[model samples]
Target chain A: MSQLKRVQQWATFARVWHIYDAAWQNPFQSAELLKKYLMGMHKPIYHPMNDCGDHVIVINTADVALPGDEWKKRVYFHHTGYPGGASWTLAWELHKKNPTMVMKKAVYNSMDRSLQRRYTMERLHLYPDANVPLNLLENVSNQIKQLRPKPKRLDEYKEEEVREFPKLIDLPKSYIVE
Target chain B: MVFTSVVNYVRARGPDEIWRKRRIFKLAAHFIGRRRNCYSIALRNVHRALAYATKGRKLKRADMANLWETRVRAGCEQHNISYETFREGLARTDILLNRKTLADLACWEPYSFKALTDIAKRRALDDGLAGIKADTSIDRIITRGTLHRDK
Candidate 1:
């Protein structure tokens, strides 16, 4: 009877895949919503020690759009240890080369940096093309809630990020006067 | 009775305002002096606090600049340009841009930043007339040493 109840609970919580026709203007924001829609944060067994969640299948990564000129302006950097050896790639180029990477990066950034992060990431199914046939959103929607609004940027935070270099490039007073 | 006692005590004092000021100053002096029993120590502590606050402000400013430089360098690398190479290209092209401004521009207006890089590319291509490889634009130089492995 207990085993039967477990199966019944799984069936009740199970999601039917659904896709909204709305444009993915903010892929990160959409991903955050879909994370809940896919039941990525819950388990039927109610185990805190165990990672329990459902897989999320994301489609139309290539069609994901954004407002403003975020692609060309956002930069990602990497380095090689030589005196003059570092390389960079623009968000626009990355979008062209691998569209799914943009959303993946956003999702990765949004995830909590705990042991569960990797487990959660593994359940995220991202596809560049919009051809997935799973429509399990009904069961998923019940457990999901809209994300809390982020606080507005304050001037103090912006002022804190400003970097000012020393005008004097000469050696310190502790060094020899010569 | 308490009010009368207080009035009486105040009346016992002199009419001069200087004495009141002196009394306040003396109270402050005593309060501070009581903490360490030396006026020099109190003065030194105040000076030290000011010095620490000044140093802390300076450190915060420097740290912010370092963050900006790091972000710009990272942004430049994404554009296939090193912070140094990008600066060199900007200087060579006579573009008077600072790292902070460049970083903000890069984040807020990427297309314009790319145009700047393209200008550098055009200059590099034109200057490589002696078979120095015109295709080695700032981007190429920046990407030449990039690691392909995932971070």
Candidate 2:
């Protein structure tokens, strides 16, 4: 069998390095946000020169539910270097057509565009289907799960508990309707 | 430091003594979970540490695609067609352009995007003959059975 077929057909991908647990729920940081999340500056092992990270494989991109209007508002753009060479697309369309590529591209772009970035990217494998070949993940089944915390109800916090933001003072007279 | 202490404790007790007791790790985790200040933070940190150690790679493609679609929708709106209508028109017209490629063209080549949109618009305008609504969303089309059934 072909290597691609073998990899695809395996019930699990063993020693697959790392796979994102479906249970993990958190908004991903932008380029700047990643620094804090990884504790880049604070870690003892911090080195400006090295990619001190492990391999990660993401599965189930189609079902990666987001919290709010992020899915509706976020815009992705690519330039092909021509007059009017700016193509943009919404996220929902890409997810429907190609789930794996959507995620792989995001992670790749989020990382520093360097040789180390390419190296880390090599470790990432994206599969759109929920039933990822079991062999790749066979040894790590105990560690993988989908355990998102139930979203806390805002009503439970009540009106007083919510922090009030500073009032806006520069309201445009034309924009104000009666 | 904690790892060394745990290792020393196991060594002092003998390997078999530690191996026989499976709940030791769980007990340690539970103890850590109960601490009011530093220990509770340490427990959560340790849990995340373990997760990062074991969790799989995630590229966050869904987020990326959403970002792309938003860009596309904004561009489509500039052309006076809502993204919902544009997508519906494309589906009805049987246009093979995927959003990624469409977004790519829309960003790089406005003329080409305009041409493609023209095709969709023409198809949408011809909806009476095609028997599909030109100005609707994919959900409505699917739900209303306007999508071509393979009967």
TM-score of every model versus the real structure? 0.35, 0.33
* lDDT of each candidate versus the true structure: 0.58, 0.53
- Candidate 1 residues B3-120, lDDT tens each? 6578687777676766645544443453444433444455556556668888999898887676567556545555654456566656766789876787677656666777776665
Query: Residue A141 error for model 1, in Å?
Result: 11
Give candidate 1 regions above 4 Å deviation: A2-4, A9-23, A37-39, A42-48, A79-86, A133-178, B1-151
Looking at chain B only, the TM-scores across the models are 0.51, 0.48
Local accuracy of candidate 1 as per-residue lDDT tens digits, A1-178: 6999799667745644334321354777876666543332332222224344566666667766665887878776757888777878888898898978887777777765777767767767677785554454333333223234334455445553544533456668889565
Whole-model lDDT, candidate 2?
0.53
Q: lDDT, candidate 2, residue B136?
A: 38
- Taking the tens digit of each residue's C-alpha lDDT, what string does model 2 give over B84-106? 66777778767777777777776
Q: Of the candidates shown, which would achieve the greatest lDDT relative to the real structure? A: 1
**lDDT of candidate 2 over A48-125, digit per residue (tens):** 353444344466665556558766776678799999999887777766767665565666667666666666566655
